[model samples]
Every structure is written in C-alpha cells, then in structure tokens.
Target: MTDAALSPLRGLAKLRKAKTRRFSSFDRTGGNDDRLHIEPGETVVIAEHAGAGIITHIWSTLACESESFLRKIVLRAWWDGEAEPSIETPIGDFFGMGHAQTRNYASLPMQASPEDGKAFNCYFPMPFASHMKFTITNEAEHDLLFYYYVDLELHETLDEDMGRFHAQYRQDRPHAPSEEGRTNEQVLFGSENVDGKENYTILNATGHGHYVGVLFSVYSRRRSAVWDWYGEGDDMIFIDGEAGISVPDTIRKPDPRIGPKAKLIADRAESVPGANDAWPPTLHGTGTEDYFNTAWCPTQTYSGPYHGIIAAGGPNWTEPVTLYRWHIEDPVIFHKSIRVTIEHGHANGRSDDISSVAFWYQSEPHQSFDRLPGVAERVPTFRAPYRNWSAVVNKTRS
Candidate 1:
C-alpha cells in the first residue's frame, strides 16, 4: 500500500460492514426536552452496550447548580465488564483543560468547544470485545441538567490487537516558597535536580501499552511576591524495566506495532552492584514548556491538534496555566511499564499546585489508580484572580 492509503480519508472509498449507533439523553415522549436531570450525589449510566463495538465519539454540555460543577461531576467508563473503570476523571479535566474550568481549545482527540467552551467533545476510538459502559456521577451540591450523545459503531468482531482507552486525573499542592531567606531568583532557579525522583508524576502504569497524551495544569500558590515561573522542571520518562518492573523480557507480550521494546537483564550477578541498570531514562525533555511544544515562557493561549497552551498564566507565570501534549503520531511504547514525570522546579525545588490527566491505551487489566480526591480537595483554587485580567489584556494592547 502507498503512503496515500495511510490517510484516514482514503478508506471512505470502500464500504464497511459495521452498524453505526448513538445513545443520547433524548425525551422518550418526542418532545424538545432533551436533557437528563441528575440530583445531588446521584449516578447515571448514560450508555451500556453488550457486544463487540467501538465508541467513536462523544458530545456533551450541561448546566449545574454549583460553581464547582465541573470538578463535582465525575465521568467513569468500563470496557468488557471490568469491575474497575478504564476511565475516571472530572468532567472538565476529561474534556482537555483543568482547574475545574473550561475555555475553547481543540486537540485531535478531545475538545471543549465554543459558546465559551461549555461544549465538550471526545473523538478517541475505544474498542470493547464483550461489553462497554459509560456513566456520570454528580457530586455537586445541587441538581444537574445534562445533555449528551455517545456515538459508536457495532461490529460482529474486533481485533484483539487494539487496547482499551484509559484516562486518570491526579493533583498535588505540595510545594511553597522557601523560608530560608533567599532571593526570588535563587529560590526559583538555584537548585540541582540530579534524579527525577521528586518530579510531579503524570502517569505510572504497568502493562503493555503506549502513552498517548498529557493534560498538565499548574496553579501558583505563591506566598512571596517574586517570579513564579515553574516551567524550569524537566520531563523524564522511565520505560519498561527501568520503571522497576522486575519481570523478565521473555514473558512480556510484544507491542502490537513495530518499534523499540524493553529488554530486561534478568540474570544479574549478585556480586555486581547495580548491574546494567539504565539511568537518565529513555525519554527526557528540556523543560516543562519545551515538553508542551512551547518556548520562551508562554504568555498567551494557543490550541493545536497535537500540542498547545490553553491557559497561559499571567505575570511571571504567577497565575494558572493549562497545557496539553498528545503523542498521537508518536506514542511512548512500553512493554512492561512506564513512568512519566516532570520536575516541579529545576532539581525538585519549588512547590506549586500541579495536576494532570494522562490518557493512553493499554492492555487490561491495567494498574490501579490512586484514590480520586473528594470535592473539597479536587476543587481548583486560584491565586491570581485579577478582575478583567488587565495585566494580560493590556500586555496584549501594548
């Protein structure tokens, strides 16, 4: 096949034998009332399919009674009847921005659309062999008026080569400025990061799969009036056996696509210290901004198909910033395990509010995720809520 055959549109010339379907929250009475009402602390299963199929698209918008509705509302999904959900995260985060807020930004697989970014859409291809389920839980204080549509294609058979979709949300508000009487310049930049042990972890998964993307958000809880640039931290990813998977290379399954595979030296002599242990990781990036495909300290918002900055923070990066990097064209493959991390500051120094939603496809049963935080903990907190955002706008006007 020529390179043209690789184009997604090229397959349209041939007809397929799959039945397309959609599950929506439509009024059964055939009225214009096309919304689902979910009371406080209620869980609703939007769709459930029993058979081989692939969920191709999902679109949703909602009205909630609480201000932190995005974080209070949670989305969960299961494939092939796994007791644990393959996907679980806050609604706003799942749509591709963070801090329990939304604005217009479009990624190849996900988007929070216009009308002020209230519309949420996802285009990830999720395949299931026996069954699939999707649910939404409203942990908000008040009721919810939700509108949604789940689109999928049904088939008699599916290839086992494809893995299931997984997305996880995580947050840490652990760092604060030093009280050791140091200048802001020294506090932010003067530190040595030897190993990435103290970095903010984005994804730590065990299985045969590839990491596809990251939705990283940073909120500054700066207590001092100084430069708050936290992007100096480097991005490091430990692959396979390097991530501390003691499994031998002989037993692990080969990756579906052709590429590099992790090889473990299972027969290490007890006499040799740290024999052949890999260091510095297989994937390392220059800085936090560099990993997200931006440079020279982002000061504005941008959204592209692969990588973009959705919420470029203000003055000295003192506010909150949202960035996304999707490895659709270049997924980090791992046969046994993968550890994706980035420093909070150069050499693990500054502590800022950091959160992320890592999305990928992995063979089931996947690693168990840390317990999702409650509403009180998951709610996004802001440090620079400057009204009219004059600093950012006037910076543009000038």
Candidate 2:
C-alpha cells in the first residue's frame, strides 16, 4: 500500500493508545479541580469519567485569530471507555453521527486578536452515562484558548407521563366488512388520566427530517385548530416561539432512489460532483423511499397544555407514528376533554391505509368534569376540516 493509505493506519493506532488515561480527576463538587490541567500552548484537553461519563458546557475563544484562519476547533467525545475519541462533527449519517451538535458562540469583533476575538459555547449529552472522554482541539497555530467547565450533576427535566393514550377507530364492527383505509379512526385522550402527581411539559415540533410525515398537526377542544406548533423534526431544546418550522406544503413521495438526494446535492455544491458554494447550501429532499418529503406544514396545538411524544420508525411495517404525551409542561387548561387527532393520509384530501398507531396522556385533573368549573364538551378544529376535525368544528372553534 502507498504511504497515504499506511498513514491512516498509523494515525488510528496512535489515537487508540492515547484513548486511555484521558481525565485527571473526577470531582464530585461543581468546583475547579486543577488536576485537570493543560499546557497554555496546548490546544486540546482530554477528560474521562467512569459511569457518570462526561457532560460538559464548553466555550471556545479565538484569541488573536480570524475565524476563517482558525481551521478546526471541535468537541470530541468517545463512547466506549476504550476506543479512540470522536469529534462531535456536524450532523450527518456518514458513520457515527446523530443529533446535530449545537454551538452558541459570541459575536466576532471587527478586529480579532487575543484581547478580543470570537467565542462559541456548546452543550454535549454523551451517548451513555458510562465511561466517557472529552477533548477540544484547535488545528489553528494562532495562540487560542478554550474556557471549559464540567457539570457532574445530571440536569433533571420534568418527567413525561401521558395517561390513557387510547385509540378507538369507528369501532371495527363485528360481522362487518373491514374497510381498507376508511376505518375512520379517532386517536383520543385526556390529560387528567395520567397516574403520577408530577406535572408535565409541552414540546411542539415542526420542520423537515427523515421519515417525516404529512398531517403533522395538533388540536385541543378549547381553541381553533387554526394554529399548529411546528418543529424541525429533531430534538432541539427551545424556550419560546414554535419549537420547529412548519412546511407550507407536503411534497409528494416520488419513486425511491438508491442514494440520499441531500448528500448528492451537497457533493455537487462542493464542485467535485456538483458544488454550490453557499455558506448554508440548499438541501434537496430525499424524495426517495428512505426519506420523506413532508416539509413546511403548520403544526396542530396539543390543545390546552398537553405533552406529546414526537417519534418515528419502528419494527412494524406501516406508516410511522407519533404518540402524544399530555399535560407535560403545565396543566393542560381544558374547557372540556382533550383528544389529539392524527391522520397518516395527505392533508390536502388524499388518502392512505394507515398501518399502526399509539397514544398516552394523564387525565388526573378531570376525575369528574362535574367538579371542575367551566368543563364542557369541546371539538377538534382544522383550517380545511376533514374526517374527525370536520365533525367537531362548529361545536368547538366558535
């Protein structure tokens, strides 16, 4: 083999050897532990923790350097307590890539230097709470420094308890001919049905991704289904506005292709196969069988305040399903009962034979509607009301 091929093998071996002995000390208190030290000139710091793993809130500064000149400054973490570390590269499915690695960097000063350069902060959730390591490397030669902090405490999030998530289609009647796609389904639930006393939080999503489906809408009996919570179809933690962007129209699924269209577009943009020299290049939908083309559609509200599970893909061979987790963030303020209506078919009046579905939410608050004030019957609303939505519009959205 040539030197280039052999070079990679040698590099891999070195990385493997350096994998062990990553972290200096494991401190329980959230205080400075000088044992975790690095040479001022050194670019990277390797940290290791057993069982607890390593979760870090990292900040990077480009001292005396322009971001363009700063080649590669990244956060690398290894899963197995042994194999060579892996940098949390941008989102891609090349080998070991999953959730998009997010960054929060400070604004760049017109004149960049050590006294005042640019900085970026990012949060990392390791693969597991097992043996882990963290390293930050600066490929740039300029004197750059990174501000690092570690969080030993696992940030607790409100537990999601979706009570009585039941789905009963227009009763699969006994001794009746089964319908192909028109079994006319009703995936319903109530927040009060949940078991635990702990309240829930609401998570609304929108936007595009693999296996994304149409009719990604939410509804409650209280307000009109005029507004839908949008998402980018990925787990992006947000504090305000819509969690994800809504696609105005759902693209029809074309014939499946062999490779990902998004990848193909990316290659072209680079000028090798086809490259578009855009900072954020255009992403072509993989209208192929492997990916879905549903993009930019409005999201349905979880009705009052309900928790919902936005999931996709499973062992079963059917259209993907998303289960709604209710009363998650706050009390699902209900004038009446709450039910989430979903349809696998096209929202523009097209139809399909949905395969499987599931739902769960707590209903503890409404042990008896008679006791709660103003608790009444509410219905589903839709801009273009169809099926269950149409039936509930007049009685609800007014």
Candidate 3:
C-alpha cells in the first residue's frame, strides 16, 4: 500500500482510543423518555461518575411559576466523595440568570438560550478524580419538572494536577447603607478606602486555585430622591498576598490639630487590613461596572462570552439587574488562597439587595461552605418602585 494511504488509516486508529468515548443522557435511557419530575423539597441525584472524568456540557430546562423559584431551587455537586459540596447556588443564578429572572444571554462557560431563555446550558469542564456527583434540591412549595442531559467523558485517568470546579452563592438583602442623610454624591465621593474590610465578599477561599468569574445580581432600593447608581463600588481581589496593613499600625491616626487637607491626606494614605496578613489579593477592579466590562452607568442589556450585563434596570436605574463576567481569557490565578470582594457603593455606602455566585477551580478537600440560607431568605423581595428616577432627580435638583 502507498505510504499516503497508510498515513490516513493510522490517524483513524489513534482516534479510536477507548478512553475518549462520550457518555451522556442519551446512553442512560437509550434515547427513550429523558425528562425528570422533581417534587417539592425533594433532592435528586441526577448524575454519578465513579472514576476520573470530565463533564463537558450540561443542558437543562425547568418549569416553575413562582418568580422566586429560581432562587429556591439549589444545585450542588461533590467531587471525590467530599463531605461538603463544592458547588452550591440557586439553579437560575447558577445558570447565569439572577433574581430568579431569565432572559437570553451567552458566555464562554454558560448561556441561556431562546424561547424566553428557558434552555440553560453550561460548557465549563468539571474534572473530578475518583468520582463526581451532582444533585438538585427543590425548595419550592410547588413541584418542578425538568429535563436534563449531562455530557461527560470518562478517561483512563485524569492528569495528576487537575483542579476541581466549584461555585458558591451569597446574598446581602440590602447592603447596609451609610449613615442616614448622606447624599449620594457624598457617599460616592467622600471616602478614603485604604482597607477593603467592609466590601461585599464574593468568595473567601483558602486553597490552590484560580477564580473563573462571577454571576452577579442587584435589586436597587435607593429612594428616588438620590442618584440611584449601584456600581460606584470598586472590586478588591486578594490573591496570595497581604490585603493591606491596618491604618492604626501603618501610619499615625489623624490629629484633630491638623488642617482638613492634611487630615484628608492622612486618611487617604492609611492602609486597611483584611481577614489576616496572610495572602493579599492581586487583582483589583476600578468599579462595579468596570469589572463587568462596561462603564459610565450602563442602562442597556448586552451579552458576550466573557462579560456582559444581562439585565439593565430601566430608566434611572429603577429595576433589578443581573450581570455575568467570566475570566476564561484572563483567569485570576492564585497559589495559596483568594478573597474576592467589591464595594456596595463607593466605600460600601449603598444599601441595595445583592447576590452572587462565585465560580472557580481548586484542589480537593476545599473548606466547607457555610449553610446556604433557607428558601425564605433566598427570595428576592426588593423591587424598585415603578417611577422614573429621572423625574424625581429633575424635581429635586432643578
């Protein structure tokens, strides 16, 4: 036989390796009924793999009327028989939607498709050694019906240095506002933040891993009298370094005898300490919208593979909004630990409902997660009053 003809045949033989075959929902039912009906308060273990493997894709569709059902239904996953789940978040938020609302959006690792964004898909590669388990907990009072297919590939063995996927959800009903009577401008401009102690924490983990990104949502509760912008906060990420030294220990406290300008300079120069002096964050973002890859008070919805605003609160920012930012192209790497946080408003001075799902990959035996709040607490209750904030501002300022 000619060498050219033999070369093509040789390539086919190498591609037929037994360890590279695909196993998915199609294989489970042999192409028959594939949907699953979940009762309220019930937990279903959807997929289980006994050896090294990687979940390549996840597709699911669910029907539920409760607007809050998105936050009520929780998804969790365990790797290597860990006692605590490494992935836990409300299904909708986990899928890229927030505030239990769905709409069309696309990202590198996740996407919500057509038909009113009912079709949720994820493309993150979740690698597990020994075994992996995925489950869904229906916390709604009404039953939920869902159809899903988990596409995975079982390999003879995973690489020795593979990190497991993880996701954690958190919420701050109303990010405690600053002292009463403070004007929005005052709150946004009158702060010296050498320390990020009060910033809203997205993820606080200790391990060898890299942060992928986060799915964030906000429900504005700022009264119409104020400039209702929720993104003046800066993103402060502490990765494998000291967050900062405490102001008291780093520099002399402001002296009353000093002039206002000198005192201001002193305050501005003071440093803030974080959880500890261990490893400080290496990544920091200028502002909320800046971190999400947008700027100058975004009011329109847009989506991309890396970062986008899925929901832009209506005129004058009087609506709930959700945004996603995946670091696939620029993953935040860390060797020892990481603490991801951001300000609620400039210097954490705004009170707005905020929730987020932080996604990352890390070595196994991760720190156990705190108990996820019950359904009642997870439900988003802050809805902006239906009024044009612009009118309120014009009347108050004019």
Candidate 4:
C-alpha cells in the first residue's frame, strides 16, 4: 500500500517508473464541449482500451429531467473481450445511491460527492488483460446529458495473479410476500428456516474470488403492522459449498458439537431434508442491521470508509433505506462458488422492495447475468396499508 504521508521526494521517486493514462469525455474535436448527449434508448461507449491496464478511477455527473432517470440509465462493462459484461447495473445504484435518490456519502471503493451527490466516483481497480469496454445505456424517456472520466494506469506488464473486476445488480420489488394469514409474530418466533431458499439473495456467483462488498437498498411497504423496522433478518453466506444441496422442509436441529460460536444453526433436524452433517454456514451475521455495521434499527444517516447507512428512511420507515459494506480490510474469499443471502425479515417474513449491487474481483469468463427487467418493471413503487382514522375514532367513542 502507498502511504499517503510519505515525503514528496519519495513519492516522486516511486512514480518515476510508473506509466498511466486517462480516458475522459472531454470534447474530442478540441472544442469547449465536455459532455455527451445521450438520446432515449441510446447507448454510448465511454471507454474502450486494448492491452493490459487497470482502471483506477471513475468520475461522472449526469443531467436529466426525470426523477427516475438515475435508475433508468444502465452501465455495463466488459473485460478481456468477454461477450457478457462483467459489470452491469443502473448508474446510480452502481455508485451507491438506490431508488433514484442521491446523497453525499463515502466508501473505500465508491463515493457520491457533495452538491446533492451529483458527482459519482469509484476507485475500484478494474484490471483487464486484453481489452476493456464500458458503455452507458439510457433507458429513460428523456434524453440524458452526461460527463465522465475513466482514469487508467497502463502497465507494461500485468501481474499473472491479477483478478478481473465484476459487479452485478439485482432487485426484488416487494420480495414475495409471506404466506397469507401469517402474522409478523409467528414469522419471527414460531417459524423456523434451515435452508436459505426463501432468503433475499444478494449474490449467487460461481467463481474463485474474494467478495469486496455489497450495496443494499430497501423501500418499505408494510404499514398496517405497528412495528415498521425492516432489518431483523440474519445474513447467511455459503462459501465454496456443495451444489444441488437438498433443502429440508423443516428447520434443521442445531449441531451439538459446533458450540454457540456458530452464528447460524439449524433450529431442528427434521426441517432441513437431506442436509449433510458437514453443511454449515461459512459466514453468518447476527442481523441485517448488524451486517451493515449498525446495531439496533438505524435511524440516522452515516458514512465511512468501509460501511455506512446512507439513507435511514423517514418516519415509520416509509422512505427508502440504503446501506453499504465494503470488506476492504477483510475480504470474503471463495475458491469454488459462493452464495450470499439475507432474510427479508426474521425468517423471510416481511414483504418489502429490495435491491442490491455486489462488487468483487474474479477470473473470467463469469456466468452471464439474466436480462434486466424492463423500464416499467424497474421503476420503484410505494404501497402502504390503508388507514381509516374515522373508524378508530368511532370505535373509541362507542
């Protein structure tokens, strides 16, 4: 790691043999224009490079009339001539803001700067050996005006062990609602879950790599319930585990030998069917709030180098809540495949809109992502339980 407090002379000496290049959206015709105009449904190639290089920095600012434009514009990046993009996500969510809203926040690999968080920056080192291609697609109705800069450090030779950067976005609007007539209390304390099949999936990747981090956002919809907290779910990550593991119908019984250190344990053996004795969670977190580096229900917004709760929602948790966690100091390494998932609520009970972006580096060619939902489906919607004040007043009077 390059120490930031080194002497100026030492810094200069270290850079004497380094070669780097930058690709920007500045006017190519030597004019004053420094932005690109992207029409509706248009795709623009922002950066294309051949040979070995590491994209060290990315900065972008966009202008659009639609409030949902941030979620409409899609960004995709391909490395090493792969047909499938290694990075594919909405521009805003890719930078940390979700639900088409922006706010100033900072993280080690990504950040949204001041002035209402219009400036999006990323410092993830995306190294490509043969070629790298990045493009932005405008999926909104209105045209988009954008300015971007992709700074790259071109190395004469790249290290053989360098991994390619990858990111994938996924969203489940109102994760399949809990079974009808199932109350929150029952879901929380009565219901048991051994296999994580019903959990909201953050990432299901097959590769040999380390997960750097993830950005998760949720828009609450349940209102009838007195309690509006949305993060009671536990985080379960299976690393390099066997495939086609049969899920039990009932929760599994906890292993007596594992001791209490095991964060996630099978509640009952009869619940999980065909689960082998060796099946155990690789990394388990206490709760969703705990996984994001927060305790209890977070009500205030905060940002840091590795984790942050960018948006904490409004009164009654009605608004969207966004959180990010970067495993820079302690990355989750996986040799074969990894499945990262978290419950929507305790035991997959709550029905709320959830979306996430997973960032990691791995050897390509990676599994291609499924087609993204169309613009109509991608748009966010809010639903609250109906309230009748008159009825309450009448009942109280009677």
Candidate 5:
C-alpha cells in the first residue's frame, strides 16, 4: 500500500523502481489543440502499453451537444490481449456516477470534480502483465471534444499475485415486480424468500478474486401506499457458489463425536439447502439504505470516502438516487466465484429503474458481458412522483 502524504512513512518515495509515465491528449505540433475531436460512431484508442505496468490514475473531460452523450460513449480496457475487455461501461458510469449525468462528488478510488463535475477521475490500480489497451467509442450523433490522461508506472514485471481491475455495467429499466395485485404490506414484507432466485443481480462473476465495490442508481417509477420509498430491498452477496455453504465435505458433513465448534458449523450448514444446489450468500444486510451505510431511507445527498449517496432523490424517493459502496478497506474475497444481488423491494416486490456498475479485480479468462443496452435504453427515464414540496429544498445559501 502507498503511504499517505500526512503519514510519517514514505513508501513510494523510498525504493520504488517503477518508472512513471503518462499518455495524454496533447497536441503534437506545439499548438493549442490539446484535445481530440472524436467523430460519431468512432472508437479512439486512448492508451496502449507494452510490457508490465500499472495504471494509477485516469482523468478525463468531455464536451458534446447531446445530453445523452455520456451514456452513448463507452469506455473499455483490455489486459494482456484478452478477447474480452476487463473493464467496460458507459463513460459517465465508469467514473462512479450513473444515469448519464455528472455532478460534484468524491470517493477514495474515483471522483467527479468541481465545475459541475465535468472532470472525471479514477484512482483504481489496473496492472497489466503483457499488454494493456483502453478505448473510448462515441455512439452519439455529434462529434466529441475530449481531453484525458492515462497515468501509469512501467515495471520490468508485475507480481504474479496481482489481479486485473474490472468493471461491468448492468441494468433493469424498472425491474418486474414479484407478483401483481398484491397489497402494500404483502409487497413490502408478506412474502418469504427461501432461495433468493428472484432477487436483482448486480454482478455474477466466475473467478478467483475479491469484489471491491459497486455503484447503484435507482429511479422511482410508481407511487405506492408504502410512500414510494424504493430502498426496502436488502443486499445479499453470495461468495464462492450459490444455494448453500461451499466447503469441504469433512467440514460440514454429518459426523458424530465432533468438537463443539465443528458440530455448530455442521448444524448451521444443514439449515440451508444442498451445497451445490444453490448459491449460498456469504454476506447479507438489512434494507437498501442500510446496505449503503445510511439509515431511515435517506433523501439527502452525502459523499464520503468509501460509501456515499451522490445524488439522493426527493422526499419519499420521488426522483432518482445514486449511491456507492467501495470495499477498499474490507473487500469481499471469493476463491471460485461470487454473485452480488439485492431485493428490488422487500422480497423483490417493487419494480423500479435499477442500474449498477460492479467494480472488482479478478484473474484472466473472465466471462464475457451481455450486450450493452442501446443508447436509448442506456439513457434513463423517470416517472414524476406525487407532490414533492418545492420550498423544502430551497436552502438559505450564504
């Protein structure tokens, strides 16, 4: 880990052999043309590197006439000449915000800076063994004015234990509810979920790596007797495999004369379904607000280092909200696989516009992603909720 500037220890300032380098959109002929003009339907290779290295930072700013340009433009990265990219998502969503909108917010690993957050920055460490490439594809109508930098360090060879950084986008333009014609109480909590098959998936990855973080955005589409609060959903994360606890037979098999600890472990294992029959959840949380480290259905925006609600909705969730949780200090580890999911509304009851960007690190040979949503679908749509008082948000600015 790199030491902080305030810390007494100087880690990187000491004996680091990695040489610093950067790729930027600078004009070659010594003129003011310090930006690239990317035409519509054009894909531009932002950076390409040979040999082992680690990308430490990425900074970019874009200007286009179309409002949905953020969603239309895609960012992709490949490591070691992989057929499929390790990092892929809409340009706006890749910088830690979603919904094709940019706003002022900051996080430990990523940030959208001031001036209405037009500047996007990312600090995730992306290490490549043999080769690395990053590209941006503009699928919008108008041409793109883009300025960016890919900062990195060149090394003779990277450590074998280093994992490649990855990010994948997924969405459900208002997911389908559990059952129609159900009362508010039934929709909220009356149902029982034994298998968790009906939950909304954030990511289903097959690899040996750690899940670092996720950015989740939601748009409330309907008014409910439950007050249109869209965060009753609980977060459930399945590690290794699904359905049941995955462990060696001796650890959970029926055995007599086992120690107290071993017997308790066995009994707990018997509580769930068969081991291979299902994907067992290793981490489970309370309501949606709780999972993001907030309480009482937050309607106010807050940005922190690890967890934050950059764009909170109106009262009763009348609009959209974008929240994030980075597990830099507490990453979820999995040996074989991991599945991250959450209930739409208690027991997967409510249907709302849900989308997410799952960010993690894994070894090579990762699965290919599903087809990215079209430009129309990638941009968001909202349903105006009932009577959000206009005066409540009128702050007394100094």
Candidate 6:
C-alpha cells in the first residue's frame, strides 16, 4: 500500500492450504487429540477459538542445518490474559518460563546427525469462556521439520502457581537528561491482587541489573478489555515512596541552558503497560530512533519522520520483502475461533520479486504479530498483531 519499501507486500494471501475439524470438548482428565503438520519452509496455525473460556497446547521443532545460525528453537505464545505476559528468561539464565537454554540458540542447529531437532510444549488456560487456537511456522530460512500437539487437556495441579504469571510493577530506563544527571537505580517488580487492584513495590536490594524500562500490564479473563490498551503513550506507574513520584533529590535539577528557541511538548507523561521505560518520566533523547531504523539503509528517497522507506540491489539475490493477509474469521471475542497466516516472497532488489506461495495460521496472536503496515486503515474492526519490528535489509548485487 505505502510502496514495497515501507510495506513491501499488501493484500497478498500467503496462507494457503486451509484445514479444520470440530472440537469435541477438552479432555482435562489426561491425553491430547490435537495435532498439526508443517512441511519445509511452510507456515501453519489454528487461528482462534471463540467464547468465554478455552485452552490450547502447541509444539514445534526446527531441523539441523550445515551452515546456519540456529541450534534450538522454542515458540513464544501470548499470555492469555495480560499485556506483559511474563519476564523472558535471559538468554543464559534459564530461570523464567519457556524451557530451553539460551545456548540452545547455538547447540540445536549443530546437530548434523539427521536426527538433530528442537521442540517444546505450550499450555494455555483461558480464565473466561473463549474460543482458542494454536499455531506455528518454520522461519528457519531453510528446510524445517515440525509437529503440533494440542487439545483441551484439563487437570488440577499443585504447581498452578508457577504457570503463566502476569506483571504487577516494573522499572524502566530513565529517559533523556536524567540519564546524564542521576546515578542509576534498580527497578522493582509489581503485580495485581485478587480484588483487581494493581500494586507495585520497588525491589530495593542492591545488585547488578539492566534497565531499559518496565511495563505494567494487567490481564483479565473478561472480553470487556483486550490486552495492551495504551491510553496515551504508556500508563505511568508511580515510583514507590518517592516525593511526587520524583527521582532521588540528588538527581533532580533544572537546566539553565534552555535556549530561546526550545519548546515543551508536555511537562510530563505516563508509561504504558509493557512499554519500554518507567512511567512519569522523560526519555533519553527525543525517541527518534524508534522511528528510523539506522540498522537498514533506505533506497527510495523520502523526507518525513513518520514514513518508512526501503531499498535494495543485487543480481541473484532475494530482495527484502513484506507479506500481508487478513483474518476471515469474525471478531475474536472470548470464545470465538479464527485463523491467520503469513505470506512470503523473494525479491531481486529490483524488478524481479517472487512473492511467497505459503502462509501460516494460528489462534494465539504472536508477539511478532503486527498490524498490516500502512496509513490507509484498509481493514477496520480488527485488532492487529503487535509484532517486533524487523530490520529492513537491502541486498547489494555482486
């Protein structure tokens, strides 16, 4: 829509080969009847299940490669009821949910023994009545082998306290002038109580930690609210016991260097749940990098901060491409089901572009899920998947 550079592909249905079967109710007592299959370089998934409450299980695997950078792979599913699902286990720590060592990033793919592979199980529980679906894709850029294991297998467990925890409170990166003015402080964790009241208390123990920012998200079973709804930028969660929720007194100061031409947008803003930094704060700079990804060069010329343009060159190369598809299923209420697929393509950095002939569908929206990119608002009434942005690489011809 905006042109191949910003959003390369539009209205391209990469999700081919549709299939489905009726659900006969989950057997929480034990056993699973749900299964899915994927061929090399293919995408597959269960779109969505509609209603008040439902459960889903998913499994996936990536085969070994001779010269590839993949060792082990695990699927990241959305937390059923919240914005920030759970803290991601640091690459090497292996302390959070989602099994698989960060080393798996290297080791799994080195298994050239033909039998080398990767896989995992994901369990989802819906608090309210809702339809659900499980999905997966083979994104290895090479041939991959995978299988799906799913079905509503209900059971009671003493370990229930351990699965799918939500966030209560989080600390974020100190924005802008503050970074240069103050000593760093550790962020505390937060969570909501049973009465639906949100609460966050700082974890003041001194230790080494990374401070990008923190997002405070709340999850609920009712469709009255979906996940990650940002009223402004990010909802501002206050600093505990700090004056005016202010920074340490030693760090606060006014810059006398304010020039005559400077402008103020808003005195202060709040942080949203699952956002990158803490709330009621200023960012390090103008947050301009979020707009332009210096990581990739743009071929086409454009002069607006909000516009995304891409470019590439090369004789026998697959030019960078973007894919698109829409959900044919109805609004995803609590229990209704639906399917979504991703398209693919091969571009020669010029005129020759071979679009994807494949697509994958799934019920749970992916973290990498994104709104079909463009300003046209082509499809209304649909909640776009909020996916992580990818680097726009332009291939140079040899």
lDDT of each: 0.83, 0.26, 0.79, 0.80, 0.81, 0.23
In terms of lDDT, model 2 sits at 0.26
- Judged by TM-score, which candidate is best? 1
Rank ordering of all candidates by TM-score, starting from the highest = 1, 5, 3, 4, 6, 2
Model 3, span 251-304: residue lDDT tens? 545433321322322223214333432323355577999999999999999988
Please write out the lDDT profile of model 1 over residues 24-53, one tens digit for every residue.
Answer: 999999998999999998999999999999
lDDT of 3 at 178: 53
lDDT of 4 at 307: 95
lDDT of 5 by residue, 1-398 (tens): 54344343455356778899999999999998999999999999999998999999999999999877888899999999999888889989889668888888999999999889889999999999999999999999999999999999999998898999999999995455555676555556545455567788888887789999999998876655344578888888877544444445454442233212322222133234423224235776778999899999788888899999988986667766899999988998877778888988876767788889999998888978888888888888765555544433433111
| Candidate 2, RMSD to the unseen true structure | 24.8
Per-residue error for 354 in candidate 4, Å, reads 0.4
Candidate 1 worst ten-residue window by lDDT: 268-277
TM-scores of all predicted structures: 0.87, 0.26, 0.84, 0.84, 0.86, 0.27
Q: Largest lDDT belongs to which candidate? A: 1
Q: Count clashes in each candidate, considering only residues at least 3 apart in sequence or on different chains.
A: 2, 57, 9, 8, 7, 65
Off by over 4 Å in 5: 1-9, 174-183, 242-280, 384-398
Candidate 6: where is the Cα deviation over 4 Å? 1-37, 46-59, 64-128, 139-142, 151-244, 251-279, 282-398
Worst-scoring 10-residue span by lDDT in model 3: 261-270
* Candidate 4 segments whose C-alpha is farther than 4 A from its true place: 1-13, 174-184, 187-190, 242-278, 383-398
Please report how far candidate 3 places residue 22 from its true position, in Å: 7.1
lDDT of 2 by residue, 1-398 (tens): 44346553475544221121232334447676333333323545455555542243433333335232222333445544544333332111001111111121121111111322233333322333345566655443454444444443332221233221111111000121223433122111101111111111111112211111111222221122332221212211221121123345455443233112221111212222211122111221111111122333323211111222232321111112232222222332222222222222121111221211111122222121111011011111122323455545444457
Over 4 Å off, model 2:
1-43, 54-56, 66-70, 88-119, 154-398
